[model samples]
Target: MQEILRKGLEEMIMKEALKKVLPLVGSVAMLAACGNGGNKANKEAGKTDHNGVAKFNMKVEHEGKPIKGGELRYALVSDDPIKGLFNPALCQDQSDQDVVNFMFDDIFIVDSNNHLTNDGLAKYKVDKDARTVTVTFPKGAKWSDGQPLTVDDYIFTHEFIANKDYPGVRYPSSVGPLVGAEEYHSGKAANISGIEKKDDQTVVLHYKQMNPSIEISGGDLLSYVIPKHVYENIPMNKVMSHDASRKNVVGNGPFKIESLIPGESVTLVANENFYKGRPKVDKITIDVVSSKNIISEMKNGNYDIAGMPADQYDAYKDAANFSVIGKPAYSYSYIGFKLGKWSNEKGANVMDPNAKMNNKKLRQAMAYALDNDQIAKKFYKGTRFSANSLIPPVFKEYNKDTPEYNYNPKKAKKLLDEAGYKDKDGDGFREDPNGKPLVIKYATMAGGQNDQTLALAYVQFWEKIGLKVELTTGRPIEFQAFYDKVEHDDPEIDVYSAAWGTGTDPDPSGLYGEHEKFNMTRYVSDEHTALLKDISSDKSFDEAHRKAAFDKWQNFAHEEAFAIPTLYRTGITAVNKRVKYYDLVSGSEDTKARLYNLQLTQSKPVGE
Candidate 1:
């Protein structure tokens, strides 16, 4: 197995190097002045002691004493409201995870080592067949309102989310391995016979086949046990949309929502009667602020934790009071082409009347055009990896053997010329077969400074190949609207940016499989579809088999010209040095940072 893995990795590197021999492709700050007395005061506070080093141990001292309170103030970046506390059903953005991580606990949670362990409410055991799993709740587990939490909560959550009436809420992956779960979720079966209540506190899940991924997915990390008492009375539609439902929903976790101010802030206070001892901090407040203000707020000590994008890391990494940690996120950014528009029914290229991109050779030539390494080094400032595969590197199943498109402008121009795209009218831009200009509009989120910069860089690179590229930017919401309007239902836009962030368990089914709703590029092949199916259903949990399957899929995607991967983001967290008990854990899929192991220092003030 070790040899196989090593060989696979070598193949990956070789393929990446063979793709392109691309063309060849910053700042200081003032020191703060301090008086002798002020320096003495800072030394006394323990703030300046840990400067210039990254601390791995989770211990801290403040003012020559151990601080006890563990209060944290975070900032929200968007206004999407969280609709549910249930994990499989939770679909809100980053802020929702922020609130849910504290308000509710999972059945089996991943520790710092990425190993799954029983936490919160249940102890689980798997039968020899690996098909039947049993769970028992801790005797004293109870909701915030003091009602006993039982097996029924878990069963109800499984049933509710599987119901077709919920539409978008169905998490078939979480329950599909169980007997009758797929049928029930797809509306072909009335109920899931596999879920049985063994007793008051015990539940059993029976599956038709052996599946470890299902077991991982069934655990609390993805499955949040819902409150049966609150849900039983609310109408299904109202359950998600009703204000009363959101206000009164009860959960079993360390904290409870004290107040929520919509787009501004959310406050949570530790639940004194929490089954587990109350969290050390009295409260956690998350305030909404724009990305531009995040660093300034952190510098002034208005916030204790903030997330800085990769491009901004160098500007803030030198701060004496801050620590920066970077890890691979579940997200990757890529450029997708409009295939439907390329093959117009009227047989005319809608965007470029010459239809230069309609030729697969031309598209492949464009794919190998830009130098990804140069982009990563020059634009990303070494904060991100040059992604060659659709699967981000964070996943164990990611195909490291996949070939990468190297940056070679000369090769790109040669391919274009061979494919018959030429400046026929001597206008300095290539033309399609129909004698129309080969100009394309690249769409991106309008106001994001980093995205805009990246788009501009791409435009410059594509123009070198005699391609006329135009830039179109929209607000985040408007950009999504334009994407759906043009790329999905129609094919007016030539290229656009899209990203996918997987959960802890990396499954590409929703994004790459046949009939995938999110496969916006509409690139499909039998080989790619078969590989995705094999990976999804393979039962041995063999890492090599999965990697090989994905490797083939990546090769197919590259040959078919589905999308051009730009960068795989490295998750970054910027926190004040005084904050203690925070550790970065590996494994799992959700990108929101985990705080289960976090605790405040014993001697610091609430904000200090």
Candidate 2:
């Protein structure tokens, strides 16, 4: 009778496991069917939307409408002050780019749906080889100062970022595919040979090979064109050192920088001569505040919009005069391992040689140990989802066929024992062959309360398996410095928590490609590298072969256990409902704070 009971219990547990896995499979299947149907419908209609350009005969009624001016006060959480007005090439982390996006425009703009949309910018085409791309500036487009927008501006930005003398502010991933970008940035080449001005309004780019979809989209959204006539004579080294030049930067956008008070706020006024037409709102003000102060300001009506973290949602969800907008953000949290830094000069690994963590099997086992669903529920209040793959489910190419590691503590212990870590000393803790406890340092940033709480929970989770973990936190700037060291492969840490904002393109090359400077894990394999290269160089966007290649890449990343994906959180925004005359764009769903299509309602007072 006892044997029979044990068998019955085992059967029940197996059924429970199947129930858990079935939902994830069903969700994926439904998503795939929807995506395939959309594609088929578009193809059958003989036309499709490219980026944000729609095929339907929809009219833009507000294009020639009268402009209504008003002041928009935004609440922002910013650490570093605005250091320069240049594109991220001068100071990447400073909140200045937010101001720049309002003041100046890029050659190609990305709409809320992650599609390339033409603003004042014009037509772009790629050659059959995919090596050369040409961009043409729209006629009548003018800078804020009324100077004609020209191709020379795009050429200047390309050359400026590729210049060795300039500050290393651009993401290396942005310039990785340009033909001469690496050599120029490395100081090996005199100048970039990839960028050339074909005429007064045309600029051409040459790449080493065809780039992945993400790289192309990033190039479009990130490469903000600068005024050549204004900054051509300025020395590159002194670019960030001059306040007058940085404060009064010129651009071809709907607004221009009016004033920036250090550590306080930045104020902007609409550009009367904006090429697309003047913006409806008259002024925009962004006030920097601490995370602790964001809620109070929002409640008091001192701020129009605030990006509240997931943990704070419950506290403010039922608040009067406020509505929480939730949408999937490309950002995801993960735990990375320092793979190449395991060995020391004595030919001994500083970590336990017999630790299952040293083997990929052990790492995958740990991933299986954690109950991601429980973490999402108890910690995030069910506002997030467990992420099993590097790419989020929103992307079409994400592979659902790959097996996900389910929560199974017994399986984790079994794998650990198989890899030689055992409780031989009978001390109730697993130990290596040398009798040392299996300990790891888990480093996280102390920038906010959420990070602290999450770190504490992770520590507790590891402790349950007889693993000793030390949690360390540091200031945001100091933490970023430590992260940079890990990216360069000089890891002083064993494990660390990080968040990656996946770009509009869902490709994993930036995180998994062998040559990627952002691959913090130092994890590389020949198979992975080849697949990344193939995807990056594939230009046939609608080809079945390209889709298959991308699917393969996603599948490989899921099986490798390169990193432990924690959760995918939605970007939440709280906005005053009184403000009207704005249409939410698809990609802008993360935050309702975008100024692109915003307008002041005629019924409301300007200062209300």
Candidate 3:
């Protein structure tokens, strides 16, 4: 639960959004064969050779018996300071979410395969016949502040999110299936009729229908509940800025926040009142480490654990003192084309049939112009793979039969030629069908030098196919500014490159739905809408039917090319040999529970 919840509830689209901060590092390092400490983590070794890819171990099996009561130092990689929005409901940045995970735990248990079970803090029973799920919180669970975890706290979370004055990015769509969530969100209903509290420990959720995604942690079926006693009186809009949301935040997880220097670092100690037994480690300290210095810092034994950036994996792959763990990340980077604008009045996307990028052939041609395969091999050293579909490979069941987009410059030129984009002005670049200059304004986020190089490489790929793709403001925009322009449907951006940490659930509707703000492309169509419905409809309860719908959407989305999948990444973490009993294989659900058994073999990490 800590893994997925560490990022957020499923389907909150982000700018690849620091989905752990390991993906943003730049600079190249030397490569070596999969080494001892790293290879021992996996039962089967990953193939490795010059110009070939090697897979790291998924878990660290350190030697020696564990000793108790040692501090675990963690590195938070980022270029900017964390915003310290500790509340999950209001926090949008994944970097901040990583910090909050130590003190918070999701209600559902996510298994190794990312499926949610009812074995965590809260237990629930889904009544298909009645279209409801009744949740029961064990009476003994208490927040760090010693307040009892109750049904009122659970209900207050939903009420706060649904309040008309709430100022967070989490939409009430997860609860839209509820009886009166729409009315509550629109300020029509005083309370959600679907969320009924039967007792102090139980709340019954009345839904219009049930879908398979509910078991996969979708639709916010079971999530962490904030202490109602602490946050009930705060104005909904001002909740994030209030003291309770920041320095005074409270949660029912295994750890409690001790102190924090906003945007710098945080110190945490074991939570004696945690529903689970106390954590084995005495204390934990997490510090914000710039991506530029993290690898060197790790070499100097300044940290016990840190996420390894894919581009820098080669440099750190041979570290003798640390074991590297790798896994298929629940995220992907994408290039989205602008085809329409979001309509607040209609509460849906309004397609611009005449939009510059609305042409299917044009979109396809642009997608073909991207040599993502070469980019992955050259820039990411095969740690990142060219994405074939929006539903990443992490979702094996649904990702299997999707369309593939490979590099084909000739095919790209042919598509453009057929679309009537020709160089009538005798310039190297092609002109639009209307014979006007075809200058595509591209918006992308700024990052390290290698990031700039990768961005420019994409532009060069477009240039080779005779498309004029220029950065939005002469260069990649800063993170916040880039999203601001894209979210507002800035006309200057015809296309943009960004990423999404596709949470634990495999549903893409939240990111692509007509009414979703995360649908930055603003594309809307009956065929697309129907396919999305098919994937999440009541009929999707049949696994085969749901998978088939997913396949159809993948094919349809690929053909539409409104948002072209760019790269599916591999997430790797380096842990000091001194740290014992740590594994990334367990999905987010097992994050906190693992800490209870975690120990240190030595007081100081290796290389100290």
lDDT of 1 by residue, 1-608 (tens): 22332332222111010001100000000000000021122222212112221222121222222256567676543323323332325332333454555666666655444445565357777783556778787777788788888888888878876675653323444555678876886679878889888898888888776543544432222346777777767676665565534545467777777887764676888876576577666787877655556667777777666556444555665555655544455567777776543232331222333333446667767777776665555444455557888777776767777777787778888888887788999988889756777777766543233334445556767877888888653322343354456434344466776655555555565555444334556555567667767766544357677667667777777777767777776555555555553334432332122343344443332332
Question: In terms of TM-score, which candidate is strongest?
Answer: 3
Give the CA lDDT, 0 to 100, for residue 65 in model 2. Answer: 30
Residue-level lDDT tens digits of model 3 in 1-608? 12322222121112234453211100000000011243376332244546465565667667877787889888877666777888767776677777666777777766777566766788888888788889998877788988788889989988887787777656645666678888998879899999999999999999876767776654547466778898888877678789888888888777788999998998989998888788888898989887667778888888888776676666777777777777677778888999999876676788998899989898898888887776666556667778889887878645655766788889999999999999999889999999999999988877554445556667877888899989889887777677779888999999988887777677787788887767889988899999988887888888888888898899899988889998887777777888765667565454532655667889988873
Q: Give me candidate 1's TM-score against the actual structure.
A: 0.77
Write down the lDDT of every candidate, Cα atoms only. 0.55, 0.55, 0.74
Q: Write one digit per residue (lDDT tens) for candidate 2, span 1-608.
A: 22332232122111000101111001111000000011122121112233211121111111123336777676655332334453434543324444555676545645555555543266677774656777788667787888887777777767776665665434345555677887887778876777777888887778776664632445322345677777778888777765534677677777787887865777888888776577767887877765556667777777655555554545666445444444455556777776653221321123334333457765766677666666554444445667777777666766667566667778777877777778777876778645677666666654443444445555656656656667643322234454455544453466776766665576677655555445656567778788877776655354576678788876776667768876675555555443442222333232222344465433232222
- Cα RMSD to native, each candidate? 10.6, 10.5, 6.8
Query: Using alpha carbons, what is the TM-score of model 2?
Result: 0.77
lDDT of model number 1:
0.55
TM-score for each model? 0.77, 0.77, 0.91
Model 2 lDDT, residue 6, Cα:
29
The TM-score obtained by model 3 is 0.91
